[model samples]
Target: MEIVSFEQLDSTQNYLIEALEKSQLQAPLAVIASEQTGGIGSRENLWHSSRGDLLFSFALPLSWLPDDLPLGSSSIYFAYIMKETLIEFQSSIWLKWPNDIYYCENKIGGVVTKMIGKNLVCGMGVNLKKNQKGFEALSIGVEPTFVCKMYLNGLDKKPTWKHIFRKYKLEFDYHKNISTHIMGQKISLHNAVLCDDGSLLINKKRIYSLR
Candidate 1:
């Protein structure tokens, strides 16, 4: 992946999406910034990332993944590769179902993936170090650029969805007690079921991560 660095950016996700539309950027490209002023989350909620934190977005060719892959589970696959990358740095980050990165009880980072025509765009934010008053940070001594490189290396393998899903399901226990929102309502994952495609089956309804 090619790295395009910025001292400041409104939103790497939006910038990358627009760049892709204009053909100004190529696939397997990343747009990173020291801080983002207009960060967003899966919901309309803001993802407030501080300076010195890891904030970036990467776009890859959709065809890089398997054709049979379920679109809803892209978050799970992307988060899994990132978690695997961090693990090599000795960071004990666990992925919350759907794709939030948590360190123990506090969230240290997260990832969200979206499709733009033939490209797959993923926005990621990790708190590498914390200020006195802020969300928890990784403190793993790993640089954001190194993390990006590691993620790209793992992604180069193009692992199948089935392979990632099989491993991710085993880690669902980490999220058993966490709270997740569904349709703007607070809900618990204690009774949720992890499907093959990474969707949570709650009350017999298949809740897709992408939505």
Candidate 2:
């Protein structure tokens, strides 16, 4: 994985997209920054990433993806990978349905995936050193580079969809458990299902579908 780090940027997402478009990089390029002035979030919301947060973006070629996997599943897969990595820090991370990452009821991070030409660009934001207002922070005692390294290590392995799904199932259980304990919500994990098209289902109801 190649990482391009910046001290400050208007938006890491924009920088990544522009870089990829300009350089015409083949695929799998990572863009990380210490601070992003105009960060983006899911559903067209503004992502308020403070200076201490971990913000990054990467581009992946669609040709490398598995034929059986749906395009929308990238976010879910990335979220699970991140949750697994955060567990190493003893941080109990939870997936709020599709892509939001919660520490304990409060959103600590999120993943966003966008399509640029024929490539998929994924952007991730995590509260590491500092937390935004109304958001919680997890002191993982690790730098963004280290986290990125760990993420790349796992991603480079190119685990099968079944392997990724197994990991997702485990995190989904953890998510339900944390929701029950922290939010007093009794959501059944059995109700949770991954649809054939990669949408997330709860109680057989479609909750979130990726782009």
Candidate 3:
């Protein structure tokens, strides 16, 4: 994988998208920044990136994945794969519904996926140290470089989307207070039903987190 590093940037996700759009960067490229002044978050929030935060954003052509892949669950698929890789290192890490990484009850990182033209861009952040925020750092220490390598490796596998969706669906029960917005309204996951495509069926409406 090709990587572009920056001492400081506005947002890794935005930069990566722009680079890919302009053909200034290629697929399977990772853009990492030491710090981000305008970090983005899923659910329309701001990601507060501080010192020691492992911010990563990568782009890949849509052809790299399976033909029947479900795009809405791309974030969960990538985040869960990262969690599984940490398990290989004997680290205790779990993923929340959709794309939030959690260590016990506290969140440690998050994943966001967007489709730009025919490419898929993934933006991720994992706090390695104290952030002085609501989220927690990873329970066990992991080298950022190692984590990035593992993530890219997982992406290379190009596992079937259904395979990933099945795994992620099993973990959704843990997030009892599902508070995600849908169609301009905050909807709880308690009454929502998890579907085979990794979407939620609430009030007969199918909702997906395709951010």
Candidate 4:
């Protein structure tokens, strides 16, 4: 993946999407910033970020993705790769079901993915040093560029969905005590069954990550 670094940007995700749409940027490319003034978050929420945070967005052609990977669960697939990358740094970061990145009980970051033309773009924001009022910073210190490179390297490998899902299943027990929102309603995962495709079987309703 080719990486483009910046001191700051309004939103790396937005920039990549717009550039790709305008034919100004290409796939297998990444945009990283030291800070993001306007970051995109889940459910249309803003991901407030500052210096020392890791904010980046990467785009890739659909052909680069694993054949078995579900489009709707792309968020989980990419998010899990990041979690694995941080684990190599000895950080206690774990991916919350769907898209949130958490350290123990506090949220440290999140992931969002979107399709643009024949490419898929994924944006991630992790608090490496700075923290908001309710969120927490990363447990271990890491340079923003270094971590983004490491993550992109992992993504470049294109790990199969079955391989990633197998490991994610082992950790699903950690989320049973938590609840996730669906259609604006909070639903507990206590009885939710994680499907092989990364969706959750909650109350007999199959829910995709769809982030």
Note the Cα lDDT for every prediction shown: 0.83, 0.74, 0.79, 0.88
Candidate 2 at 47: error in angstroms? 1.5
| Candidate No. with top TM-score | 4
- TM-score per model over all chains: 0.93, 0.83, 0.88, 0.96
Q: Give the lDDT of residue 1 in candidate 3.
A: 81
Candidate 1 lDDT tens digits, 112-173 = 88899899899998888886676788787767777887787888888888888888888886
Between candidates 2 and 4, the one scoring higher on TM-score is 4
lDDT of 1 at 141: 70
Which tens-of-lDDT digit does each residue in 62-164 have in candidate 3? 8887776778878877888878876775465777667888776667788999999988999998877676665567635666767777878877888887787
1 or 2, greater by lDDT: 1
Q: Residue pairs in steric clash, candidate 2? A: none
Model 2, residue 188: C-alpha shift (Å): 11
Please report, as a residue range, the 10-residue window in candidate 2 with the lowest summed lDDT: 177-186
Sort the predicted structures by TM-score, highest score first.
Answer: 4, 1, 3, 2
Model 3 score (lDDT): 0.79
Which digits, one per residue and each the tens of the lDDT, describe model 4 over residues 1-211? Answer: 8898889889999999999999998898999998888999989899987788889999989998999999999999999998998888665678888999888788888999999999999999988875556457874677889999999888878899999999998888767889877777888899999999999998789998889
Candidate 2: misplaced stretches above 4 Å?
A: 131-134, 173-192, 201-208
Give the per-residue Cα lDDT of candidate 1 at 182.
Answer: 77
- Residue 137 in candidate 2 has what lDDT? 75
Q: Which runs in model 1 stand beyond 4 Å of their true positions?
A: none
Two-way lDDT contest, 2 vs 3, winner:
3
